[model samples]
Target: MLFRVALATGLALFITQIKLDFFESYLYDMRVRLTPVPTTSGNIQIIEVTPETVEYFKGIPKAEHHKKLMEWLIPLAPRAIVYDINFDEILGSEKNKKEFARVMESFHQLFVLTNFLEMRGEEGKLKLSEPYEKIKLFSGPKSSDTANFAKDGVTRRMMINYQDQVMLHPFLASQINTEIVDKFKIKGLFDFLETDQVYIRFRPTGTYAKIPFHEAYKGLISTQAFKDKIVLIGHNLELSEKDYLMTPYSRSSIAMTTTEMHANMFDTLILNNAISKAPQFVNTLITILISIVTVYIVFALSPAMGLFIIILLFISYLLISYFLFWPFGIWISMAHPLLAIFLCYYFFIPYRLIIENRRSWEYYQKNKLLRQVEELKTNFISMMSHDLKTPIARIKGMTDVIINDGFTVSPIQREALDTIRSSSDDLLKFINSILNYAKIESQGVELHLQSKDPNNLLTDVIRKHEFLAKVKKISIETEFEPLFPIKIDPELMKQVFSNLIENAIKYSPEETIIKVISKEIDGMVVVRISDSGLGIPAQELPNLFMKFYRSANAKSSPIKGSGLGLYLAKYFTELHGGRIFVESVYGQGTDFVVELPQN
Candidate 1:
């Protein structure tokens, strides 16, 4: 088990680091997309430069237009304002410049966003675009707002430390402030951050209150909603992909604008919820443990129990991983561990089936050997019984000769000779029963079907057993209805009937009458022979006709029986297309019923 676990774990973790990282990131994105941390994006607000504002201002508005917009927001008492728009040219009039300066100084910290496009010219020379001299005139730090999207083209991280300092890069403005982690230190972020870490956790779009730039300037803005709030201003023209980018929450191919992307990052930082990825070693260890545990239970337990446990373990792992990702912001290895579990199930179930099959094969082999031994024992009994029949017949013939040829010396000698003859007859009958059973067991009994009178045949069988019944002081009663002359093997049916009558007489009490009835019904011949005798127990009824199986009473009593009588009776009756069964109540009475198909 240990070896298999090790091998499977090795194979599963053998995936290249690149492949593993990709899948791990994919799974993380899925968790974020499905069960994002429930947060109220109540604090964030965006003021977009919509197409209506552009049309109102006639083409994209100029810097003086932004200055006018900020003038309207100053009375709202915003904590800070972010301008995602660029000022690449000098203001046309000094009047416009002074108003822009005043708007910038009105807020405690106004972040003016900048864009840097690094491209190669035709001569392979670097082309850098510098902001207009007017942009430098504004106060406060003007950081580049270019965000770094991941390799998969997903914009998941909003802030990364630069020159050992965590700087607010892009865009953000807030209306509410609670437990904000926006001021988290750079050194602390570096201690846990990875190059591939996803720090941006965005709530659903439309969580923030957004208004058009023109609407805020036209007395449509409310001071109560913006008071002491952070205000962000950006362009959100319809059909504009110039600033649009993909966020973690972006579905299909629909990407959110870069302005919205930055807004989500600021919202996440403020909430102090920066989800972190566990180290690579952490995933490796988890893979090893998951593989080992799966192998231990599946390989060591029964198939049913193993399968049940695996399902439960799989479900538990999924729930744990999800909860850890959410609210806890801990990313563990899901695909790696789950793949290991799948591999275990794929191989272990068939291995268990093979084990069960081997056990079944062993059982089959043992039963076959037992059957062969039983056959050998029956063959020995048949051989010995056949040998005894000749000797018993000779003994009976010699005793008869001595008594009939006047060879008896006296009354005591005559009685002794008679006893010898009777004992020889009894021995011959026992031996014959064994030989008959052996013959039938080998399927050697051939039926000789003849249309014999059913009543006559039954009467002959009962008459043959009359002497035995007389000896036991049991009377034989016959009720024979006029029956059809059905095709039958007379000799075989006679023995079948004879066996029933003899058993009745042997087990019945003195002065009890055994009734033998024969009749025709439903194109069939039915015979019922019943006696007030030692009845068979109900539990023993099913095995009554099994070869060498005797009733409990018969086995315990001194009554002479080979236990093959009823078995032979059933076989002979079936050979003639008939069936025989017995019904009995313990210690009360027993009845034997026979049914033969009539044509």
Candidate 2:
């Protein structure tokens, strides 16, 4: 059990640690979109560069655009102006550079974007895309990049510093109030603060005020309108070849630009709604719990009940993870934890089967004594049958010879010989039944199948019982539709027919009718022998074919019967790949049906 528990838990953690929670992270994005915090518009705003504005400055220098924007906004004394666009290359003439640098130095709160180049390994000096000399000198290498795309290429998280490169939103936030970003400095999945990350709680689109640069440059808002609010400037969707990332608010072909992403990150940090992955220990505990619980359920319950509860367990865990994690700004492992539960249930099936099979073996061992007693009974029946058949056969033979030799005898003596012959025949039938039963017990029934006409078999059985029917003053009626040949054991099928017809004659009253019918029904050969005489009670019908079982009516009647005939008939009929059934109403009538597959 411990080994299985360890295996399940280890597999779960392996999937989780490999960051294979793609589906889980997708749900996290869904959660962010569903339950967004209130818009934080009062503290932040955006200035966008649209296609028209980019066209407006097509032939002009990039420095001229930055210079005009700085000259316009410096008078308002905004909290900070962080650029989300890359200004990595020097452009324009030297006069243009010096002019932009002078305007940029006037606003001490201005911060420009820095781009980081990724290397093969983690340890190194931060490789930066060198911005235009003037912007770097004024903004002091501002890394205003808050994008952290997960495995599915969606920006759902933000890191304070990634691979020795500081991010933008928190950088500006720390400058505004060091304590604002300090509260979110919690340890991440591996207790590594060097690359700590948290989920960004985004707001709906239009949550921030954005103005095209043409409008902002041409008096979009009053000069006093920008006081104390942090401003972000970057590309708008109207621009071709623009930088964009997928956010919770993004859909296909509609993504947020770098400016909007920064706005959301800034708000998430200040509002303190940053979600973190649940602690590793909590995740570990949950994985172990699901594994052990599913294993226990499989071991303790029946397979069907175990399957039902396992399904319920899966749904319940999902609900719990959604509610607990979404509201609390933490995400528990969903994909792999569910995988753990399923693995435990699925892999433990064979183990449970082996245990059940062992238990069945133990039960069979305990019943050894009962099986031995049954063997002894079959042996005794066989011995008695061998000893009794000789005398009965001799008596039947002697009586037949004397009766057929034409010896003259008195009427009383002749009648006595006839009685002896009849008694011997009954004894011979009883002995044969016992011997057949013993043979069946020692070795199972094996059929010597042959294709025979069912109609012929039925007529032969009726003729053999004609004398008894005549003696009881019962009329035998036949209605045989032409039947197809069926594969069956001839002798065994004949025995079945004789047992039913003889029972019909023995139980019937004088002047009753016995109907024997054979026909093809539903592509199979069917035979029914019905008697209008002492019918079986409904309560005893279920056990009528049991070995040596007699009904109450039979016990009270004067009929000489051993009660094994119908049992043998049923056994033989089924061995021929056919079925026998009895239908009777108490004190009314009885009917026997035999159906065999026909070729």
Candidate 3:
């Protein structure tokens, strides 16, 4: 999980570092469009230099017309006048230069635009283009120019400082009042961008109060409109694309005029509004956190729920970004965090599915092989038990016949015949145990259930084990507590009791006591068979009832028997909804307990 988050975060940060222009521009423009335009303060106004005004002054030089307009505005006493036009060339006669300089100097507050074009010299070093000598001399310290736009030719940000010198908008703002100038000195005027530039918090396009230059020149616009207003004079005519620039508000078919762009900058300064990009580390942290959460949610829920959560998260992130951009003027990179979430979920879910499917297939194949092996084992045990049962029974019968025949025989022959019969009986008992175990395991055993007295059932099992107990000289004792009748498979119950008693007689020393007890307790019947015997070891007791399991002590002892007795006993008892348990201590004694539901 950590690896997935790290990979996703790395990929997101890499993409953000690349700063793809189109993607970034799209997001930035969308944010601009969605933001509500703020109410205008109407303190700044534009006087457009339209084509009609240029045509009106065609016979005369453009500089002379600018001089005449300045003459008309000198009496209005405007707060300040900013020229967005570039007067960077030697124009007109010497008389025109002196008259323009004189009129420009007369204004108490004035700023002029100076174009500084960066060009490579012969040595490939950048050089700044110089402004016209007359314009530079007249504008003095108030000279400033527009900043460079992005590579996409869209003006999303404004330059605050270039080459350690203040740019136009901030320089103009500093000249407004001592307080604003102090703010400029302390906070500096622009919010930082990826390239250390600042974004322009643009109002809606053409939002400022605008008037045609022809109208203002003809005295159609009243002087009061210019009073106390910072007036901007620039060309808005559709002469060429030279004065037109793309902005966040620019559409495929429309672009804003450079005059309007400068006016927007001026308005931003007045309102003290700036948009700043969030720190890179902040964006990276958000990306990583969202990526980890996406991975966890996808794994923890169903695919549909995960997708829903992703959509919800996307919307929530958009809201957060919008709030930051709108009210707080903070711009954070949204693409990376959203993309991190998408890629983490998309890649991880399928990878996990493929892994789980492969494991399931392996388990299926293993189970198939195990089933085949179990069937073969059941068939082999069934056939071997059947084939051995008949021969062992016949051996016992022939030995019995010989011993009973009327004939004279030596004492050694008589003892040999008796030994043969006993050996045959033990072999037959072992074969029967194997057959019964296999039948039960193969689901071939059918129960003949009836309501039978627990005492009678246990007594029958004891009677069957009497001969073996007598041979070992072990005394069998019984304690009964009037057990209620229980519904059970009689033969299966008898087999359970027979195995317990036989094991007690086999493991006990001669003359030891084997006690059988039955009682009703807690709505259940419990039977306990205990013996003074060489008890099972503590470590081997857990596996004692497992199929074909024998303790080390039992394997080395002289007593001979198959190990299926206790395993089959446990199986048959459970089949009748009963439980079996054992308590033992090494070298002391052992007790086997069976509990059956009374019903």
For each candidate in the order shown, give its overall lDDT on alpha carbons: 0.70, 0.75, 0.75
Evaluated against the true structure, the overall lDDT of model 2 is 0.75
lDDT of 1 by residue, 1-599 (tens): 56676776775566323255445657777888888446755665688888998788876766687777777777777766766655544244666766676666656567655443212242212221232323322211212113322356665554443323334432232124333334433111423232212366666666666898788877687777676556677777756565566555664334666666666666655555667667778877887787778877777887789889888989999899999887677777788788778776777667767978999999999999988887887799899998888888888998888888977378899889978987887788688888888777666778778998879988887777877788778888888999868889888888788888888888899989999998887878999999998799899999999988988889888788888899989988888778999899887899999999997
Q: Per-residue error at 241 for model 3, in Å?
A: 1.4
User: Which residue ranges in model 3 land beyond 4 Å of their true spot?
Assistant: 2-16, 54-61, 88-97, 117-150, 175-196, 251-254, 370-599
Clashes per model (N, Cα, C within 3 A):
3, 1, 0
lDDT of 1 at 349: 63
TM-score leader: 1
Write one digit per residue (lDDT tens) for candidate 3, span 84-105: 7766442565567667667876
What lDDT score is found at residue 101 in candidate 2?
Answer: 75
| Candidate 2, 1-599: lDDT as tens digits | 77766776776666456554566767666666666455574678788877777677773227666777788888888998877765644366667767877786677777766445333374344432332443431111212223322455666666666555556666676655556555345322222445645566677666777877877787778776688878888877443434666666665334667677778777776666666677767877888788888888998889999999999999899788778665676678776678777777877888889988999888888778678988999899888889989988998999999999999989999999999998998889888888889878988567888888988988898888889888888999999998767788898889899989999999899999999999888777889999998788888999999999999888888888898999999899888778999999877899999988885
